[model samples]
Target: MSSNLPKNFPGRPASAPTPSEVPAPAPSAALPKNFTPEMARAAAALQAGAATAAGQAPSSGAAAAEQPAAQARGQAAMPGGPEVTRGEIADHFAQRIVRMVDAHRGDSSRPRLYAIEFPFTDFEFDVAYALAGRLGATLSASDAAVDDDEPARPLVMLDRVLNNPQQFERIVRHINHGQDVQLVCTRAWQLPQSVADLVDATLTIPRFDAPRFAAACVDFYELGAPPALGADADWVPNVVPRDFLLNSQVARSDIVSAVRQSVERRLRRYATDDALDLADLAGMDEAHDWARALIDEVALARSGAISWDDVGGRVILLGARGVGKTTLARAIARAAHLRYVEASASDWAPPQNEPQLGWMRMNAAFQEAMAAAPALFFVDDVDAFSIAPWAGMLPAFLEQLKGLSADDRVVLIAGAQSAEHVRFELHRRGALETTLTMPAPNSQALAKMYSVLLRGSGSTLAQADLEHIGLLSLGMTGHEVELIVRRALRRARKDGGRDVSKEDLAQAIIEQRVGPESQDRRRLMAADELRNTAYHEAGHAILELMRTRGARLRYASIIPRENGSLGFVLPGVDESRNSVTRNDIVEMVRVALAGRAAEEVFSGPEGTTSGCSNDLQQATAYLRYLMTRSGFHGLLSLDRSFEDSPELRERAESMLQAEYAHVLGLLQRHRPLLDSVAKLLIERQEVSGDELTRVVDAYRSSHPLV
Candidate 1:
């Protein structure tokens, strides 16, 4: 049967109705439909008093005003009398016990009784049951007849009628009539003024006992005993006896042995050669040798018995997305013969009575796994766990790590996108141990990944194709490489096992490439932008060539490709040349402005492209460098900080404005060359460096740079 129940004390027997229930107290009938301003103020005051009694904040105005008038009426009806609802009764008893305890503070010799009160609702019942189980107490319904044989454990009343003030009054009367029991309640209801007067001085529930409440629920539901609480004998594994694998020189073999035993116990089933071959299980063999080596190293380390103090307790495999952090973690678990438990940080939350039941279960599992020792607790995507200020039990989670001992065989491996964040959190908690970063797969690694996929599918991929795949997968990680190979296999399967062709691979690469369909469009726009950029670069190249005969323009072209550069000009110059003259700097500025000038003269100002954002930034920085560091500004000779000076900044801006104007006029005079070059680019879409050099040479033959 579902363990659902309401959160309140059972109502009084119908046959013997109390005065609070019969003759309908007259004050309730006279209560207002809505609280008057004065009444609202009074209710707020009462709510505050009640909250203070419960050690919580008062409800807001809307909530305070909406409470059933029956609460206030019940209080008014029992100014000094004996009538009240089950809720008020629970509050009254709780208050009395609190008062007794307060009056007897520091007098432990006095009779001690603890009462827990909750509404009999399903959530409250679960909480009560959990608390009872944790406290090792027996729980009975409020109406269950108590026999002499029943253990006299502390009583917790689950009263459903605690919200009804009339019913609560009778409960208080029952308690007052010499029932030697502590009182507790789940819901907050108005307490009588007399009861409120004594609350602060009398009753309190300690915050540390919250977990006990959680444990109670777990036990009440028979969720099964937490693994931490299970008998140690139950954890023993059926494995063949083996000698202690240890380095005799290491004094910490005892510690290592404990951890090894713990790990072996949990993973006894996977302690075979076949089980160690997880690479094959994962359909990967290109890196089979590497995988085998890693396994062998782990096995050797396990056998060699390094001292516990020298051995690292935790291993972190850090890498960019999809580099097999999880895969490595699983392999480690298999290698160590430990149970692998995977959980995400996003899956945990602060314990709540109802909603947090699942988190409690997880907590139980975590503790159980830890107690089992020598286990691999793989926490995946741990970066997603949130920390909030109001979370009361957050420290408990962190405390679990703090409590780990050298004897504990628990090895926690957490995965995240960035090691920095995880390291920061661990450092803040002082829990970090050892870390290992996984690098992006190199070309050889990519080739291996490809070969593995191909061999697994019984298809052969050529070495040239593998090289091409490696080149294309430059920045990819192990996981991404595997995924790409898997995708290729899927494609091969779709084509009926036909040999995967270069065309098929190219198609896949294009599909995987960013902005595939937009490639042509982007290229077109980039080419237009490049045409203008080429003219600008040509202006600089021509100016330099004229000023310094040795400054030869080797090649210039407008071609659009990845990295967003539209046009480039390569000057055949010494690679070691770093410093340039003032004239050279001026020519560079002229080149920077050439594209803008060419667009204005040939394609009109409307033809200017947004692709010049980078160019403009580069040109501005160069101009500033000249003014500040290179001392190219004719009148202003200052340090690098000169760019920040208003005078130098204005002069630099003016110089660039004048240079751009001059370049624009020069482009207008040479409009035919600009048009011819642009036409060639539009026709061919792309031009080789040689083709561009020929075009420039022809233009210069007719119109010299000078």
Candidate 2:
């Protein structure tokens, strides 16, 4: 056991308690009349430390020479000088702690065990007597060097003890047995895992941040507010006089601003240019609508117009890649005037070489973000890191989101390419209740978006023209739409000037879908082979233009290109309304076999080239969906495991062959229309959906359907 007396307290001997009229330390700067406990401790510590330094100056050796200058700056000439004075403040602190601790435990004779895990620099082990006094115990109130001993009764000191587990384990064991001692520690993570349940509760004292720093400085210095801090971590005032932080005069607003600046500097944050307005987000109706609500709600809550429980919370936006989900999230945060931070997926699931380091960095980022609450965290592609191979680290991430979601200030918006594919338990109702799938832009929305994108670039294209472009861009993303305008401008620039023609934009959409001709090998096909490719592609165009069945064909080109294709066709379909059936499958099979059928009609069996390879694969995939996935053909097997059985392959092959025969007959009957389309393709090399539909519509008006 150690003495609880304030003995050896500089100028005072080891003795019983006495109300020493010790002159309080005069602050270097002006302070307010009223003071918190923290302020009082700081003043007394600085005063006693200064007195001790002045008295010992002659014997202080090298420090003796610096005494005059040190006094001018309000500092002790010797090391750990302020700590000597802090022992004096411990007398008052001890009494207050005992009162609070006893109030919690009632009048019971059993001593209640507790720990004060303060930072190594701010640990006040000397004040253990105040806590131990309720149990008629005593502890030594002394400080000058770091201690790691788990002292009996009142005092048990540890200096960065979490870094030394052996000593920590011993202390934890003692406490877990319901011992009477009150121990002090520094970090919660440092606690022994074996005694986790024994801990009654834990309270976190956050690091010096903007709001608290401002309040502390304002009251401590008797000033209106604190000075603005810069992004530099070392920008704070020197407040080491017994852990009483501020002694300077600055304003509250400046302090908050400085803290905001520091948060951006110390944490992973997005730049200002990344902020988008909610009105600017295009084609993500579900996400966009929800964002408007979030912005409004966040505003109401920030202004105290709404209850705390009504504030925005967790949101998961499930959609395809490049669909503006991340952008939408940023826009909402910007509108709500909240700081935006991104959780890096790559960092979360790091390389196998140093995975532990990666998690540590990720956790640090999360902690820093939490430290600056009332901010928005944008986590893109969460499913990438929150899954099986790396699931061990996922719970920690989820726990963070759960914690933030419950807070009235923080807002979390997470995005994933495929939500159902995400195996994390966050998808459950309680974890992330507001999960929404982003709806792709329809023709109407696409028209509006195109007009908005082109308006800045000086486009006089009418509403009808915008609608036509939208129809062509049926399944394209917003990013792809921007690319269309850029590609159009570049193409127009090559043709004299940047006054882009409608055809140039149309061609841009074509190249965006099919591989650009520049990417193809320079090896040109023979004349006959070129014509064969044209006929194969034109067959697809005729069905798309004249047949009035299946998906609409948006672009067709016979030019050899990258991706191993001599020609490719872009088809348009509304994925949102797609409900595939057996008939749709049969019609698509005929369309898939159309190219081969056209090739056979033009030059017989030998002319039927390998150009139909893609078509066959497409048709077979659809067949599998029909048989196994959709159960369209009465395959009652509810088991979703992929089927590669010989019987299944045979059935698919038989169905494809039947469809191929029917397609051949249809192309033979409509060979002239196919030839006309093929001739046009061989000449122009590419045809837009609108032009194809226009010419075919004229032909159809003259000749009625059979």
Candidate 3:
């Protein structure tokens, strides 16, 4: 057989094929006149396989033609020895071309079969557009896949479009039929079939987290290059390497600014690492302190003053959603001068990949982070990663994290949306010796923050105005406060880019109560549904004011809104506030049951709807805490066997029922107040605490609570 392959190609036939050993093509050969070097090697492999099956021996002329190449790769991992049989040659060719396709193919739509397993769907673009973005090709998409003029780029929307014959055929033709046609799948979606039928070869991308996310953005912008590159120092974000790919398109400053707006837009959920600028950060003193400690530890490790394990291997940042855990972790990394590499739960368990491979992938990711030592290793949404009874992964990941933390040069931080079940797993084995809870800023801090954030938008607010806004937003996370700023900016842009008016600030607060964005597009509630919602929220408002001193009631809304709420009475909790007494717990249960009790009293049981499910759930959860968290339940000794669970349930149910009864009686006595508040809610669609109080006061003057 003749050959043309890379000189370093592994597994050359392990012998010098002497002049007497070469074999020739058969006399009836149908070889083409022109073929690629790769095709020539393939044809040679096939010829050798066929000849070996037929028991043919090599001739002198063929041996002479291929001897040097054979002897060159003689020691490669081929099974057989120096005689160099036809089967051996075919195997060698297979090892070279088939086994190692990925390393050589970078962004080339090569002739191949492969799959890509994404960890999560950050952005699920259309197949045509996604393919165009990846391949640097243009494609015009139509409603029907078959109707598209271009068939050269055969993309697949395997998630939903696979059932469509045209799309399925396109996937098949892209993989099994042609060379130079690349196949692309849009974001993370469930796989329709088992791994075998669907995937040929899966492409695994490097795990991306906030640090790498920041680094990539920095690298792409060339924001700060080495002094040799002559870029301004301020242009560079404080990010270092694990540099993957940089686009270098010289994006317009406004375009880059627009990309940045996405960061602020997402601040309402979690802090984007890129968006954690020190100037924008406010009210996370505890988390920032943790960041400083981690930075100091990293510096200590570098100076040989402490081992990596001694760097306090893990920090568990506990907070509600939209809190600054992710942002704080990123900020710590940037301040500590470490690269950030984030691996998520989805990264550990991707769809379609085998369970074994998933573990291996996760383990490999940790190893990679260690290689990028002096890096911040973060695990985000850890609770979501393992919400089941036993995640089957906790032990291994826990150990891996602990091991990495001890490395003396790497830092590990885990962000939990809530630190409930996993807290023990994190703290028990000393896996995470340190725990930091990132609560919301206090009213005073929030007032100060509001002043700063509002002023950043070129708006001014009086001390009284800031304090009022802060009181109204007392329970909000830092990200939520930032979102209010983002909203004010949006308003400022609308109002000819001037300053944020007081009305703009008021509207932003209203948006926080009812929306993450505009809610005008949602369907309006029917008149009856609107009435039920108004009265339900009014019940919560009245109970919150009369019982908790109007401190808990932030704003009551009857409008359908974000997070699947039909109506809601949001309560404010001090950011620095921790520990609720048993009475506080009981009062909270009553407040939660107020909406349902109101429905039963005024509209009857049939009038109640599924809208009260969340309220019922909250009340049930607090009651469960009373039974289980012995410290709160006043139990001197506890037994978690839960053997008396039935009795516990009965007691909890009875207590909840009594609270419901109590709420019912209160609503009955304040029927006039309830009617007055509900009427105002229906008129205005929202009622702040002061308005609710004023209405209640007016009603009491007309009909006293006594």
Candidate 4:
């Protein structure tokens, strides 16, 4: 027995009744504000039960409540005189509750407000159910109604504060109304300061010992033998459910097999044989290394070499959607032999106009994760939850995370779009410390991914061919790569179920990464329309060659595209330069409008076609970016629609006009070179790479930038 009691508690009187002498209160008798005769009797009953379990006499302390001799210890005797066991946990916790009640009996003004932190809900339930029965208390949620005249009993608040802190305010109201209540909770971190002050103290139920747990199971289930556990076992009494032990087909002699069957049934959805191992994942080497360290720590914990608290697996996964964040998280869980539980940001979202529901759902998730320890708790789109510090329910979310992080058996993995968008405090120590970004896999990594997906599919490709296909699908995500492979497989099926060839894969890539092939549409165009398309593309190509030093013209096509382009100029961007300067943006805007400029320069303003509509829109976008994001208009850049501000809109339009005129004049000055490129494009449907580069180089050699 221990006491962290306040100084004002009075000493126990010598005349107080012993364990067997306390009397039950009358139905009409007014109950004391804090201490009730029923509670004292209940405490005595628990003490007597504990003493009997230990084969000793009950101490001369609180008096027992009236009950059958067999039921006093939560047991029941059959008609033939055989006694049913009530389990060790009930007896063990009974003694602890007796000491707690005795240590605090002198306090007469406040309720018996105590918090009990347990590892999982089953343990919490076992302790709570037994404690409530012994104390004659009602087991209720925070919202359950309380009768004022009932005997004082511990009001067990299971995961209430963490699930919804506002529920505590209701509790405060109950206490303020002078109700005889005792508060017991699983968490105190989310309790409001007012309620926290009223709480007497908190205690933790230690992890159950294997022998005690097995003994309880054997006695409860009447099994032929006890289930075996490792030397460093962390098993709980309810890991194998009562119903399972009673009804399962596994032989009673093989208790271990029954336990395994029950666990697998419970976790059938999470741990599957087909789930990829951490080693099988590709294109995420950094995440692979991170998971390797975590897996090793999990192994160490299982081996009893280290505690789960020492495992550093709490991390936030940052990446674009469809970049395999969820897949990678699942793979890690599989690798670590953890139960997988997933909740997205939307899962925690409150109903529209019902803000209180937010924390309610958030707490529910944390509660579920806690109940499933040695599990992976993954929350996708965490940015929506922790977008900013002042966001509603973010504090409660953090509090729940803090409580979860303190638990050694569960690993927290949060998925988000970007690390910067999430609150920095969320990434601080004791929270989700590691931030792993799953960027789009590069060409080489994509090549490996392709090879993996194509294996056993009867699709064979040379290494060079795979790399070439990977290069062609450069900007696609891993999901996109998989989609293309599936499409390729389908394509092969249409062609008599033949093995997927390089041409099939390439076509699939072109369909997804590029727009639909438009060769038939291009063939339908008039020669005059083809010539006009050539001139428009030539306009963009020549200006790009002249205006930007880093921009390389990959190709220019006079063929119509499925995306409504009559012809287009594709430029290869500089991979090394991550950001563009203001000057670079200016040149980009000019190149975007050059197609329209070339039309007027060659065929006069009246002859310019609506084919320039796309060009005008592209140029307008660039000009808006300069005004709103690049601070071209002012020192304070506002990332908003230019239409929101009249002045900003007018400024953008003026910049677009100025750039258009500038490119028009430049095109006019280089009329002869533009004519040469247009003529070449008119002869061949496309001009690209070294061929296009040489034509521009020859012109630049003779006519250099001033």
Q: Please provide, for model 4 over 1-706, each residue's C-alpha lDDT reduced to its tens digit, 9 standing for 90 to 100.
A: 1132222223222233333322231111121223333343444444456677689986533122212122432233233321222233343454465466657656676654666655444344444544554554444433334444433433445554334554565455545654334444446666666667777666655444577566655654455567677664543432533323333334455554555456556657655355566766777988989888988998898787988778886688899988888888888788888878888765666655555567667766776665556788898877885543226666777787777654447787889996766877777777778888888877787788788888879777899989867666676788888899999999999999999987788668756744766767635677667777888889888877776556566566776667776677767555456788888889889888989888888788887899888778888888888887776657887778876888878888888889889888888888888899999998886676447889989988988743
In terms of TM-score, which candidate is strongest?
2
What is candidate 3's lDDT per residue for 1-706, written digit by digit as tens?
Answer: 2244333322234331211211222111133322322333334455464567579862322332223322333433233211222222222322232223446466676565444432222221222233332333322222243543434433423243343456555555555545333333321122335322655555543334444444434433333521131233221222112122122232423323433343333222222345455444567776666666667877888787877666764777778877677767776666666667777755565334233445555655665455455567787766754554227557657766644435325677877766665546767666766778877677776777777666545566688878778787776777788888788778888888787765576568778766743366266668888888888888888777765422545677766656666767777654544566777778778888989888777788788988889899889887777767747767654554334677777778888889899889989877877887888888888667667777767776877654
Better of 1 and 3 by lDDT: 3
Pairing residues by index, what is the TM-score of model 4? 0.66
Computed on alpha carbons, the lDDT of every model, listed in order, comes to 0.48, 0.58, 0.56, 0.65
Report how far off residue 229 is in candidate 2 (Å): 9.5
TM-score of each: 0.43, 0.67, 0.52, 0.66
Give the number of colliding residue pairs in candidate 2: 12
Ranking by lDDT: 4, 2, 3, 1
Cα miss at 317, model 2 (Å)? 1.4
State the TM-score for model 2.
0.67
RMSD of each: 17.7, 12.0, 16.9, 12.3
- Which ten contiguous residues of candidate 4 have the minimum total lDDT? 24-33
Q: What lDDT tens digits, residue by residue, belong to model 1 across residues 514-599?
A: 31233454434544455566555555444444445233444444544354555555444422355788877777777777766766
Model 2: residues with Cα > 4 Å off, grouped in runs: 1-204, 207-274, 306-309, 344-346, 350-359, 371-373, 384-386, 405-408, 427-430, 490-501, 519-524, 546-548, 574-577, 627-632, 635-648, 697-706
Q: Pick the candidate with the highest lDDT.
A: 4
lDDT per residue, candidate 2, 1-706, as tens digits? Answer: 0144233233333332333312122222233323332343333444455567688422322222122211322343123211123322333344444445566677765544455443322334444322332333323222223244453333333333333445445445445444444445434444445433444544343345445555544443334446555565332322222444212242434444443444445433444355656786667767767778888888887777875357655777888886777777777777887767777555566556544445555555665444445567777777775565456656656655554433425677778887766655776654566778887777877787777777667777888878878888888887788898899888877877767767777778777887567554456778888888888887777765444445566787777766667887777775455686677777776677888888898989987887688888888777777787687767685443225477777777788888888778777876767788888888888787667777666666876422
Candidate 1 worst ten-residue window by lDDT: 17-26
